[model samples]
Structure formats: structure tokens, C-alpha cells
Target: MRAQRGLILLLLLLAVFCSTAVSLKCYHCLDPVVSSCNMNSTCSPTQDTCLYAVSGMQVYQQCWKRSDCHTEVIMNLLEVAKVKFRCCQFNLCNKSEGSLGKTALLGTTVLVAILNLCFLSHL
Candidate 1:
């Protein structure tokens, strides 16, 4: 029946849409300046987090996983103060470029959802 065909089509669409191709990116900088972002990393799928570290006068930004970014550690180094590590979930949130680009992520999500729906309707 047509209904059966539709169901089969729906399943095929789901299979294609469900496959995730996530790529995480993070910016690196010694200070919080967008232009000063000297590095960037394309994190593996497991590393679903981003970390920003600051200590005394040094700052670093990179991608990390949930368990990788532990709480801050206060240590003494001669006359230097302890380092502080901050974690954020948003894409490029820890970047010196700021979080204004977050809206782009929303668009991507919506596109995926729309693709899924389109597949279902055709089925």
C-alpha cells in the first residue's frame, strides 16, 4: 500500500539524517583579542567542549571534552598566581572573536531538522 511505501521512505530518510558529522572548532589567543587568535583546532567528535585558561598574564583557548576540562587549580609559582580554567559549551564561545557567531549554529540545526521533515513527508 502507499502507506507502507511511505513508512519505508521515512525510515530511509531517518537513517541518512541521523548520521552526525559534527566538527568542533576553538580559537587560541594569549589575550582576549579577536585578531590575536593565533590558533584554531578542529576537535574530534569526542571533544564536545571548549576551554579558556587564564593565569597571571597568560591566556589560552582550545577545544576539550566534558571530562577533560576540570575545575581550576590554584598553584603558586615563585611570584605568580594560580591559573584559572573556564569551560563553555557554545561553538567558539571561548574565542576572542566573541559569541556573536552563535546564530550560525542555529541555522545549521534548523536545516538538519528541515531535511528530516522533508524526507518524512516524501515517504
Candidate 2:
């Protein structure tokens, strides 16, 4: 009986962590900056990924389609001579915020697991 309860709690916690609250989001910047960009925008449903690019002193980050995540496509679209690019598919996953979201999620997951274990202990 306790094992069943523990398994149920674990499944519930997994569902909570796996669900998406909203559409994808990406940091939005098209200017020269020395570090991470602070601005962001929620992506349209069609925009399935976040794009991050750096060219010389300038940085670019925005919503992008996963199909168009190639260097040549992004370069042509952004009109850059040479640029480095990264693409990802999660909230602010262009990493403008530097994994704070992941850290928060990890912390929340740990807290929930602890509480669930405590609750199960009494059952």
C-alpha cells in the first residue's frame, strides 16, 4: 500500500514538471550588448524554438522556427556577414537568463519530492 502511494506521488510530480504553462518564449534583442539580454517575448505557436546569435559586437535573440535553425538561413534573415547561432525549445532557452529557470525548477521539484515523501510517511 505504501509503495503504491509513493508511486502515485512520483507520477504526479513528474506530470507537474512535464507540463507547459504557455507557448514558448525567447529573449528578444537585436542590439549590441556585452552580456545576456534582459528582454523577452512569448513566441507564436508556429515559432517552436528560440534563436541566439552573436556577430562581432552585436547579439540577436528571438523566436524562431525549428526548421529554420540553420546558420545560412539565420544569416540570410538577419543579414549578417558571419554569426554564431544556437537554437533551443523551452521557455527563455536561448539562455538570456542563464539557467535560472532550470535552477528554480530543480528547487521546486526537490521541495515537492520532500513534501510528498513526508506526506507518504504519515499514510
Worst 10 residues of 1 by lDDT: 71-80
TM-scores vs. true structure, each candidate: 0.48, 0.64
Best by lDDT: 2
Compared to the true structure, candidate 1 yields what TM-score? 0.48
Q: Which lDDT tens digits does candidate 2 get at residues 55-75?
A: 888888899999998989988
Question: What would the per-residue lDDT of candidate 1 be over residues 1-123, giving only the tens digit for each residue?
Answer: 666766776777577544422566666555644446657777788877677776656666777776656543212321225667766665566754354356457757886896676567665
Number of the top candidate by TM-score? 2
lDDT of 1 at 55: 63
* Runs off by more than 4 Å, candidate 1: 1-21, 30-35, 72-81, 97-123
Task: Give candidate 1's whole-model lDDT.
Answer: 0.61
Candidate lDDT values, in order = 0.61, 0.78
